[model samples]
Target: MSDNDVRQFTVGPDDDGIRLDRWFKRHLPDASFNVVSRWARTGQLRVDGARVQPGDRLAAGQTLRVPPPESAVVAAPKPKAERVPLSPDQIELAQEMVIHRDAQAIVLNKPPGLATQGGTKTHDHVDGLLDALQFDGESRPKLVHRLDKDTSGALLIARTSRAAAFFAKSFSGRTAKKVYWALVVGVPDITDGMVDLPLAKQPGTGGEKMHVDEEEGQPARSRYRVIERAGNRAAWVELQPFTGRTHQLRVHMAAIGHPIVGDGKYGGQAAFLTGGVSRKMHLHARRIQIDHPDGGKIDVTADLPPHFAESIKLMGFDLSLGNAMIEDGPPPVTRADLKAKAKAHAKSVRKERRGERRSRGSRD
Candidate 1:
């Protein structure tokens, strides 16, 4: 392709519904985002003969008209980061964690204490070991969702970009269902209830902690049902979070006054327990159900980690009783739904007050 000639490309099925800028990044590596933005700004970029923004979604079979590459507008290429080689042991460890694998997805029974992704002072993580999970695929599997460092169980990985996008939509749209198991301190008075609370990053915590803030916080809701109680000491419970937030499960459990065992960050000293119980976090992603890219659905369950299993055994709780409450409930309500509900409640209150006033006037 010469620099003077305009370029045209057809969007593929796999690239459907992706942003225009992302399409550029995937197919045209030489074109930087800045160059693409410049082209869009000058009306040199068109999709199906219509000018489109960088964030515009592209449909399959649509024609994309790209202007000729201009030397003055294109930025210098960035140096590619060197790929670190994985050791044989690391590869084996990664493969061992895989509990379910298909063409589109790989679900790992992630153990406690392993970070989902690398960060400051964190060298080992599931993201780093993902290269071993790439089994003859064109690209490495991508993480669709994350589990905290001390939280164990099912973590989904997408094997292709299309699958990644599909799984991400399921999660963001709240269609994907995730069930977690935890042993919390003290049994709740209510056997089953929903915690409709908002959460925000705690001040002075450097964004590492979350706290319940009804006044200024994002909406967060969690449903919990006590499965089995070990006297008054602790209770094995099933938790389903409707909204995903930072440290949401931990923060919600702690806010309800029944912190998950070994979660010292939110629970403090009360998080730990007496006797021979392991001081490791008890929360585990027990099950995940989401629609697959090709068709059908992916419903898989992860076995408990060693410590969690041991604690369950120590508490003498029957394993069979854990999944008694697996029936699905109403979907999570949106902000609009909440507003409508509040309006209806206010109207009902006003009607009741008017009736009370009328009855009092008749008595007088």
Candidate 2:
């Protein structure tokens, strides 16, 4: 089609419920996001004779009307960074981690010591190797959530933009259920308990460390049930976080005086154990269950990593007993619930600050 001609296209079955902007990226790469937004603002972009925004979801049979391309109206496309090609071994490693794969999502049993995404000093990560996992998808799979570098378990990757958006909503809405298995240094006095503590990034720690702060901390909650105990020395526990916070499980366990085994960052030297227990972090994302974009639920469980499995065996605990204690939990906290809690926390902080100022004035 000529640049002077207005374009009309029908959405396909494959793109039945994808965002308008995503359709363009998949089918019309020349039409940049800026170009689409400008057309929408000018009332020239339409779907079924109705002016539509970039985020509007399109149906399979819907008609899309696009204005004629303008040379000046479209911004110059930015240069994309060159992706380093993965080595043959890297591709094999990525493929080996896949525990579940479907049309919408891929679940990988990420092993310990592998970073989810690359960073300043880190070049090798699951994100860098996603190109090998593209399979039949038009675009590279997107990461829906993250795990710590040393933590191993079920990591979900969205195969398409629509799936990515859906999975992201499930997480942000707190509808996704994640179960974790960790071996803590000591057994908790209370076998099953909730750690309802507000956490804040510790001062002078470069935002890398979190500590409990009743005064000005964000709300973080975790529930743990002791599955089995090896005397008072250590225990295997099942963990579920109601709110997602950085290093939440590790911090919450440590704060409760039962730091996760081998988590030296938060647990210090006490995190380790005697009698030939491996010093590697024993946290593993045991299972993940969430709603799928296509229809039913996507519930995947990851096998224990080598080190964690070894630790469990050394502790003389039966692996099958871990899932026997599964019990129904209260409905996951919604986004609105979190907002209300945060607002209350902010109000409390303000009241305390005001009280301190009034006390100083009275002293003066």
Candidate 1 clashing pairs? Answer: none
Residue-level lDDT tens digits of model 2 in 1-364: 3545878899876677778998888887678888888888888889999999998888878999987665325555679999989999999999999999999999999999999999899988999999999998898999989999999999999998778877877887778889999999888999999998999999999998999999999888889999999998999999998888899999999999999999999999999998889999999999899999999999898999988898889879999987723344556578999999999999999999999999999999
Worst 10 residues of 2 by lDDT: 324-333
- Clash count for candidate 2 is 0
Estimate the overall C-alpha local distance difference test score of candidate 1.
0.90
Pick the lDDT winner.
Answer: 1
Candidate 1 — worst ten consecutive residues by lDDT sum? 324-333
Which portions of model 2 show Cα errors greater than 4 Å? 1-77, 324-364
TM-scores for every predicted model: 0.87, 0.74
Question: What TM-score, to 2 decimals, does candidate 2 have?
Answer: 0.74
